[model samples]
Target: MRLLLLAVIAALPAAAHADEAAERGEWLARQVCSNCHTISARAPAGRNPRSPPFSAIAARPDVTAGTIATYVRQPHANMPDHGLTARQAQDLAAFILAQKPR
Candidate 1:
């Protein structure tokens, strides 16, 4: 029983970490990117006609996870700075990268 309890304790932290990561990812996507990009697997069209879907963005071979994070941190002149912190940007990037091409 003690060994079982210890195993559960060890697994609990990992489960919590995954939950935190998923929550952060969802928050970042909804708060920041949902307006312009579709992060869902459903691939709903973007609200902005000019903006591409998240799947499309992720499909680009040249755009790696690091590139996405950097771009989010330093967007182009036309793009408004959403004022996301570094950690938020990284979390957002991870979320975006997690999306597989539909």
Candidate 2:
């Protein structure tokens, strides 16, 4: 019982941290990515038609936090380099992944 209690206690902070990260990511996306990509679920299209919506990215089978973190760190075609920190990237990934349909 003690071991189980300890395990549950240890996991509480991780869940809280993930929630926090996702919140921060949402803010960052609205401030930055919103200029091009559709950051909100309610939005049908982005300011730039070529940029994929956050929902679309979240729906991809191959998308993961690690993959998004890596992709955002590098420069890509038509996408500007935001020079996001590792933590910010992870938060952004968390926010994006959170949009995945249940």
Candidate 3:
């Protein structure tokens, strides 16, 4: 059983890291993104027609992690630039991607 236990222990860091990223991303979304964007499917009803839901963005064919990272760093006329760091952008991207429709 030692070998099996060692395997599980060794495998945990990556999973934990991903979980941490998703958590940070959710927090960032709630604090910053939620102001204009609906970050979930079951969010406040009657979303603003102008802003698309995060789930929809996540589900889009071209919305990769890199796409999200780039968007967060750049200036958009509508979106408020939170001036997120690379790690923060990565975390948010992971969170958004995680919300993709199964």
Candidate 4:
């Protein structure tokens, strides 16, 4: 019973942290990426040809959440460097990764 209680206690914090992360990600996506890309279901009209949709990005095998975050922080090529901080990029990546493929 003690072990079970301890496990439950440990899991509670993890669950809370995950929920917090998800919330942060969602907010970041809405604020930062929604302007250029469709970050959510009701994104603003105006698509850029520069990058794929967030859903497509999420489904990409080569680009994991971490990779996306890194790229967003320091973009390459014609992509103008947005200068997103590490935490902002991480949150955006988390939001993008949470999206389901269409």
Better structure of 1 and 4 per TM-score = 4
Each model's lDDT: 0.74, 0.89, 0.85, 0.75
Query: Could you tally the backbone clashes for each prediction?
Result: 0, 0, 0, 0
Candidate 4 or 3, higher lDDT: 3
The collision pairs in model 1 are: none
lDDT of 4: 0.75
| Model 1 steric clash total | 0
**Residues 65-96, model 2: lDDT tens digits:** 99998998899888999999999999999998
User: Mind giving the per-residue lDDT tens digits that candidate 1 earns over 6-97?
Assistant: 99999999777755765697687887677877777754555886776767777888987678778887868756788778777767766676
Candidate 4 global TM-score = 0.72
C-alpha TM-scores of all predictions: 0.70, 0.84, 0.80, 0.72
* Model 2 lDDT-worst window of ten: 38-47
Candidate 4 collision pairs? none
Q: What local lDDT does model 4 show for residue 78? A: 44
Tens digits of lDDT, candidate 4, 65-91: 689889888867845677888877777
**Most accurate candidate by TM-score:** 2
* Candidate maximizing lDDT: 2
Estimate the overall C-alpha local distance difference test score of candidate 1: 0.74
